[model samples]
Target chain A: MADTSHGAAPGAESAPGMPQLDFSTFPNQIFWLVVTLVILYLILSRVALPRIATVLAERQGAIQRDLDKAEELKRTAQDAEDAYNKALADARSQASEIVAEAKADIQKDLDKAIAKADAEIAAKAAESEKAIQAIRDSAAKSVAEVAQTATADIVNAVMPNAADAKSIKAAVTARLKG
Target chain B: MATEEAGNGFNIHPMDQFEIKSLFGGGPIEWYSFTNATLWMGFAILAVVLLLVVGTRKRAIVPSRSQSVAEMMYGFIHKMIEDVAGKEGLKFFPYIFTLFIFILVSNFLGLLPTSFTTTSHIAVTAMLAMAVFVAVTVLGFYKNGMKFLGLFWVSSAPLALRPILAVIELISYFVRPVSHSIRLAGNVMAGHAVIKVFAGFAGALGVWAALPILSITAVYGLEVLVAGIQAYVFTILTCVYLNDALHPSH
Candidate 1:
């Protein structure tokens, strides 16, 4: 390092005043600047900048691809859910229809069974009425016969042949008629 | 420490650090001479290459720390160029990025205990600013032809005042390069000089030098901040000037 140890030289001399204002060193500074700056420009434009740009673009692309995949999966899930709902609705409607048909069939069978019961009861009642009529006739006949026998016995005991049997029979018949 | 003080023992040569001499030996500086300026300038380039090229050699999907840093710088400069200069101006991004990185690296490297601050020199900054000025002027003409001069003419003004406004605009336009160069160089130089002055105080103050040491630390921190800011300012101004070239009427 060339220290400027020598006291400040006169302004007219070789290295005097502000070294910055000194024109002698201007070329050296400018030349290197141009060289260094040009090289830096080349490196930045051609080598460095492109690498950074590529990394950023790659990251962005990866993110976009993942998002698209996720969206597709979400859409598939939604479709499956929609299909399940449709199947569930169909099953509900089918179940109700089967229940309605089963109810109609059971109702018809019940109505048929009730009609058969009513016909059987009517036939049994007719036969029971016929039996009651027969009994009543028999009972009337027995009563008449008994009355005739009693009259004959009484007449015989009281008088031997005085009273006619024909008269007694006719009297009994009139009483019964009255 | 002994060399910093003069015979009087209270002297401080804050400006001595800026002196440039040949690396080989003391002699008259030739146009082709390799000096301390050239050495630090080389270091600046090497730093940029190490960070940008070697760091990104793998080009991994998951970047290492160095790669991320490189990518961040790339993106930042890229966005800055696009934002200030419009999309068309991005064609010049390489040049602008080079300028920014070199200056920024040079400024930070200079913060090293004995390192030279290349950006602090007017010759370097002037060259850069003039390069921008020349390139933009050429690009403006190349793109818009005679219409590029419309940057100077303000059509919205009253007809009588248009010419006066154009003169003022022209003067400002010409002043752009001077201001651009000086802004970076001047900021860097001032910060360095202040630190040097404080360091001198620290030397002279001896046992009670803690005060100047603290001030130096604070000023050094500010200088680091200024270094980055000046680089940003320089690059963004370049973009703005390029924008004017691209859309002269605007």
Candidate 2:
């Protein structure tokens, strides 16, 4: 291929030389390179970089906001829990007070009922005692009347001849007295 | 040349791939004429637009695949500049990002079969390195005035050795652009040329073509890694140079 290179001609078009060494193409390559670099720089600086930076910043802000919201919700939950505990404590106290009051009222009612029963028992016992006394007085009077009648009948049977009723009654009374 | 003689049994033009041709038809490569270089550079620009501009059109907080790639490139370059060049260097983020994306996309595009590798050209990489060199030098002087010259003077050295160290530093400083440009172009050009040569061997050794083909595959994979690494190296070097400009103390 080296010998076939069209007879040692200078700057021959058919020569397979290193194109990078070709100084003639430098201006073209450099020019396009500048154009490309400038265009790339403009696009990046003006549009792409700013956009990406903004997106990243916005994402950071969104994350922070979500964290704050979560914290607030947790606080609210804590507050709700505290309130529930307080309400539970208050209800328990109120129930105990109700129970104490009910106990006191029941104790007062029991004392009143016992006092009324005791007074009724006392009145019934007094009435029975008065009736027993009346019965005893009446029995004693009947016994005395029966004794006088038996003594009068016995005297009449034993002494039939003595016929004066006033005299016999006087004699029986005197003998009984003696 | 000896490879050319050895390949006398079969025709192989490995260097032919680097030849610049007019995109339209046969014509002299004029300064403004559209060539394959321009076409591929245009493709690189279109890729940049598609990836950075069009892909991020939604501006989503949770990015899609293409948008994620765009953001990753953005974040990668951003952190690199900040780390190497410090906070004030963030002002030059767009310029550094442009160089990175252009070179990266161009290198990857060149890996496509029959696609031209623009970064493989000394003209292109030299231009890029020269631009960085010129920009950083001007920024150094502008930001520090005459103090920028202190970069070459090693104050930490012994007094007797200072002048010699400064001379060495000065020489190295001037050679930066040359090495920077040549490193990228050389690595890219060599990889592509080797692949082409191996492909030619596959054609010549028809029955035992699998050997060259396998070598080509392995080289191509390494080339893929080189593609990304070269781009990273170029960008980071630019950052280091920019840092020297901004600080210039050590």
Candidate 3:
């Protein structure tokens, strides 16, 4: 009676090595196992997995969005660079055109100046030649008249002879003719 | 969780220690106590739930530290599901994730001092294993309906050996739960018992006890690792089970 109350107490020896299998205690554990599994399933199906999946998809979407933004920025940068290059090209062409135009205009103005100077030089030279010839003739005539008058006056005073004066006049006429 | 003289008349038994109980049908069954093991499972599950929930509550655009951790866990599961269950079979993700978490929690819980490891109980493990069994069988039915019956018959086997193969398959199917449950429960139960026995030395040796402490500490660390590893084993087995269900030809 005492051994029975204690359960596995005295005189309960089995064959020394082998352990006995007890078939009686599984009902409650099995019951709870099902219960817990069912409850866990509910929690997972309803809550955890769905939320986890949502977060995962959100992260995927975030990464995707960032990549898309990066691509867009890259495209935009490329476009900006292209536009800048084109603008620079345009500016360079425009500057070249302006420089060419300036060169042509200057060349035209320079040719016109050269032509005007040539015409002015030609006119001046023609006028100067005629004036120089007239001045030379007039000065020569004035010199001859002054010389004749002085010579006549000197001869008349010194010789006081018509013959002397005639001789002087004849000599002057001969020198002049020579 | 106290049983008051359990049952009356033919079914009467004491509540102090673990015992086996018979099920509705005629077969042997055992009942286990929650004493240390069950307590551990509770704490571990609470820890897991708290981690995922509290860790992932805030959704930041550029995720906070917790969010990233949550995201990593989510990604791992997603990939595992995709790889093991395949893309189309991901509908079972919830069940798989739950199994993983619960087992993981239970295993980890078993490692703690003064905690009951529910997973160490064969009855509990058998129930989990049975769930997988039922789920896979149901999945087979769902995917193929009547055609899934072909899973039992090895048409490729020699005609002479076909009957033997069918019997083999049936027995193997019945054995699945046993193997599944025993693998987990045995590892945990044995591990903890060893630890406890080793820890018994410190009391026996008394006062002069550097050796026992060092030994117990080693066992403790090993148990901790085993806790995590056993959880992983359970999870992977679940995957393989899911795989078997999803693709019945194997």
User: TM-scores of the models, in the given order?
Assistant: 0.81, 0.81, 0.72
Docking tier of model 3: it is: incorrect
Expressed as tens digits, the lDDT of each residue in B1-250 for candidate 3 is: 0122233112222121122222244353334444233344456556766767766666555677866766676677667878876886577777777777787777776566765577777767777888888888888888878777677788889988988998998798878888988888888777777766556555556675678788879988887888778777776777776776777673
Ranking by TM-score: 2, 1, 3
Best-first order by DockQ: 2, 1, 3
What does each candidate score in C-alpha RMSD?
5.0, 5.8, 8.5
State the iRMSD of every prediction, in order shown: 2.4, 1.6, 6.9
lDDT of 3 by residue, A1-178 (tens): 2322344434543211111122233555665566566766776677665676677678779999999999999999999999999999999999999999999999999999999999999999999999999999898778776777788888777777654556666777677778
**Candidate 1 lDDT score at position B157:** 87
* C-alpha lDDT score of every prediction, in listed order: 0.86, 0.88, 0.68
lDDT of 2 by residue, B204-248 (tens): 898999999999999999999999999999999999999999999
lDDT of 1 by residue, B171-236 (tens): 999999999999999999888988888887888887989999999999999999999999999999
Q: Best-fitting candidate, measured by DockQ?
A: 2
List chain B TM-scores, each candidate.
0.96, 0.97, 0.77
The DockQ of each candidate is 0.47, 0.48, 0.17
True lDDT of residue B10, candidate 1: 62
